[model samples]
Target: MSKGFSKEFLWGGAIAANQSEGAWDEDGKGMSVADVIKFHSKIYVKDYKKQMEITSQQIEEAIKDKSEKKYPKRRGIDFYHKYKEDLALFAEMGFKTLRVSIAWSRIFPTGEEEKPNEKGLEFYEELFTEMKRLKIEPIVTLSHYEMPLELSVKYNGWEDRKIINLFVKYSKTCFKRYKNLVKYWLTFNEIDSIERHPFITAGIIPEQCKNIKQSIYQAFHHQFIASALVTQECHKIIPESQVGCMLTKLTTYPNTCNPEDVEKTLIKNLLNYFPADVQVFGEYPVIIQNMLEKENIIIKKESGDEDILKNNTVDFVSFSYYMSLTESANENSEKTAGNTIFGVKNPYLPSTEWGWQIDPKGLKISLLELYDRYKKPLIIVENGMGAVDKVETDGKIHDDYRKEYFKKHFEQMKEAIEMGVELFGYTSWAPIDIISAGTSQMSKRYGFIYVDQDDYGNGTLKRIKKDSFYWYKKVIESNGEDLE
Candidate 1:
């Protein structure tokens, strides 16, 4: 293994508002698109060509039709009400930082409101204060796939340029209110994924925009402007704090040693980086622009968007690297049944029940590549293995698989650090397992401390420390060397 990380390395857990905090309708919180989407009961199989063919209008029309049966409400775990206890559990795990997001609707209620909601602001204030009391730094995502339903309905979400100004207003409020406590901020979580899954991310069905690529590009345009503008605002308001953008780093590997496979891998890498590179590097990659122009989908730009992105790049790059994908030109080749954009298979790797490929080495590759390209300190905002844990009759979950998964990943991270990747921290996803994002169930667990719950939503709302919990605490305490 490579040399261990710096002694001052931060170790913690990452979660989002919509996923863990299940007060979907409380304290004036507006409904988000997540509230309406059905959970995936079975593993999501990817048909790459079919997924590629799906347009924004097609998705939007399906949403508008509303003939689909409704799923159960995701009001389980109730982190809104249980954060105090939950945070205490996090503190027990020796967390140096706690990554979470503030719900947009909770803070703004209406996207364009002149005055913010005091109660909404107060909820986060108390949450942050609790973290501060425990000496845990707050890593805040300004927006995490949770937008006010009102915004999507009235302003067409990020497709409308007006939302940029409103987003800035909300971000500024977060800066001013939590400036003292929040030292790290992310403008948006997985901005690229949101563009890819707009109906799921922002609730602005693609039908509203008439064109998928145009809608996605337009939505991304506004998000880029907002992220850049918010970075500038945070600097102005909180000079000491660092602001960044978070992306879902679904790393890709070549299907074979063949040059064609390598070339396909490179193309997929470029496609993954398209949204973020444009936001951080200020100009669109020539290939993507050429493709858009060929397709006649021009992203309309406002006056100062380019200048904003050019002048205000994020201070750091953060991402969640759960798994990797292997790419090939042959579409019919057997692939892992994963929930990735390029749903190709990795011949050499095993996969989780959910179809995500298990690839700890990909983490090291991702860190090296991102650091080389951006020349900025990297923060791994989320990395964890999601699995079904069997609770023993004694009420303890061994979870050795989780322990082994993280151990290998941490070892590789040590290698990346020695290779000169300036890593700021590593925060595993779901320090305490909450609801699963894709399945909207607690069964697809990814936490060190497993909460007693299941797909049918029946179990004591009990929190038990899985064996991995103690295992990770030791690793963190030793600065990533103590793994047994």
Candidate 2:
């Protein structure tokens, strides 16, 4: 039998600042790219192209908009006000690590600033202090789904080379301030999503750029450099700190046994892994370089760019693994939607309410593949199913489905460990239900502890424990042995 979770394995949950902290403009916080994203209906949720496209007109309108309800991210579950209560709940569940992101806009309201907002820095200091008090190790992600809105409108986001220095400045400040508090840092959350949702990932508006593909890849290059620079700075400031690259691990499989389908699947999987390859391996893969040349996408690099990446490679690999996908060469293949990615449907796998294919085995496959490829410690930062949760009159939630989902995934994780994967940690997608990142809806819940909120941002904002909460608590207490 495979060994259970290691004694030092990080058992916790993950949440982003933009998706959870609501005080949009309070206490010197500036607007982030996520602030402008309005909640669309379910009909438009899966329409990735339409949902991601942002125009100058939309930007102008969103800037002047004053309705927080329309933009649910503007007023998240108010984690700003209720973090103490939330952290207590997490502590009750015996959380060892909690993955949280710091909004760049909060520190540097505008992308370019001489000094960070003191109030913003102070806020994080208090939060991190609290986490330390609770003995819950804080794993920080410097950037999640958003950067400052000012950068997008004025500098055209990461497409501008100047943004690279600004990001490095912000990261240096973080490393210096939280040197003792935070030891594990991730440069960006799902760095691969820059191609999937440019607006959300890098604040790049497609219409604003002259060459869309070139601009996107150029922006990606800047981020890659930024991540490396930050990793380097973390080493200088906090020698013991470990910095890792974050990727959206969208594992893909062949849709059929056909050779064409198999070839297409291989390419698709490589494309998804390309970004991480650069981050962890410290060089762009040959396949990606060939794609850039074929597509005529030229990335302008300044002096030391190549050396920066080559020298400051991440210490570990962290990723968000919500679902897997399949690819087919056939034009008429059936399709499904996932977390900002879609692929042909797999006949053998079941899907969640959000259309994300639920293949527990995929987790094992992804771990083995990533470990084999990178030979580094890996952490599952985000993995959970979002469902429309219901509450009983007695104030109880019987979410056997959610419990089973984690149980199966945990079993697969054990299998991978037995197979010799150097797994570091497992922080579930969310310990508390926060606003959905892609859809920006609260109803699409993925928390063991439910938050009383709705799609329109109206609720008592009460946090309630679900049945899975107890299940997870036992799993953690027993170190993954007492799943039943």
Candidate 3:
């Protein structure tokens, strides 16, 4: 047997609102950036630029098109109505906590409204109350790729700096409203992904910008200030709250021992850590500042931006570790996509069908490094594989592949905890199948409980427990002791 996890260690699952909640226009909800994105066929899912590139024209057309047939997110497994049943299923799995995001547009509609939407507020109150009854803690993310579309159109998302105050208002309303329901808050989901999917992450339309990188970095600066301000307000509203910064931890390695490859890996790693470094350390890394200067990208800051950031550093760090990436200096090296990045593939590693390489050891490395650097309590907010599961004739779904995936990662996590890393929790990316955030494909599922839905949004919308569901219930019952 392994050293095992602490009794207080949290074991649970996570889901984002925009990916699971399907009432896009119902109950005073407004259009979010996620609502305008269309689903691509499985064959074309790997075309990153085509899949994510959003234009103002596309937004206009999407607004006019009322059908959710093309846009899968608009019909996200109908979680808006089925949440009670979903939460009960999670409780049955012995979930100690559940990480979920609030749809910003649901509360503020166009994000400029003076009054909060009562219907939107009511929905979450009911949801959280259910979790409390089930003895589950809540880790709430304020924004998770679900920004109001009006802000993106009028102010170009975070580029114009006006979004800072607007976001603060929205966050303030949430804190005042849900103070008792939520004890843990996250400012953003994958805060480092602003550049990967610009419109989806930060609502920046590339066609409106003269220089994409400048606008992206300017938006990044605004987000930093906004995050700091939110952190400050969360502490004031709920003194016992533990606010955190979230990142997509893409641990990179040198393809070989060559000095050139090592240097390339180092640069990649630095950029990967830059976003979290700013949040955790309360200042920009000197190297990143120098790089920004060389690029002639100047961030226009307000008077007290530095003080706000320094005074309101995160209480803890949370991140998603999907897989590890390999770096090489050779431009001709074989490239494969992994967690929103294209990198040289590691031959020693096995990759999922989506080309995400499996690297369980990378989780241990990430935990140790993050704990050593910040010395802050850490939590794994998102980590799981997406795959196609087969339902047998008897209506049982046997997903042994996913079970094996989690087993290997859990063992490595045990090793990390034994080595004295201060990890407090582990929440899988999703406990039940939701719409795929990257491609909107229902077939590429990651869930212990299976949702009956197809890629084009056609199914009975039934819920079936996969074999991993029972296995996970046992693991949580044993406190991460029963890997078999």
Separate clash counts for every candidate:
2, 0, 0
What lDDT score is found at residue 289 in candidate 3? 92
Q: Candidate 2 lDDT, tens digit per residue, 184-277?
A: 9999899988888898899898888888889889988999999998999999999999999998999998888899989998888898898899
Models 1 onward score TM values of 0.93, 0.98, 0.98
**Residues forming the 10-long window of minimal summed lDDT in candidate 3:** 41-50
TM-score, prediction 2: 0.98
lDDT of 3: 0.91
- Misplaced by over 4 Å in model 2 are 43-46
C-alpha-based local distance difference test score of model 1: 0.79
What C-alpha RMSD separates each model from the true structure? 3.2, 1.1, 1.4
Clash-forming residue pairs, model 3: none
Q: What is the lDDT of residue 454 in candidate 2?
A: 88
> Higher lDDT: candidate 2 or 3?
3
- Candidate 1 RMSD to the correct structure: 3.2
lDDT of 2 at 329: 87
Q: Which candidate is the best by lDDT?
A: 3
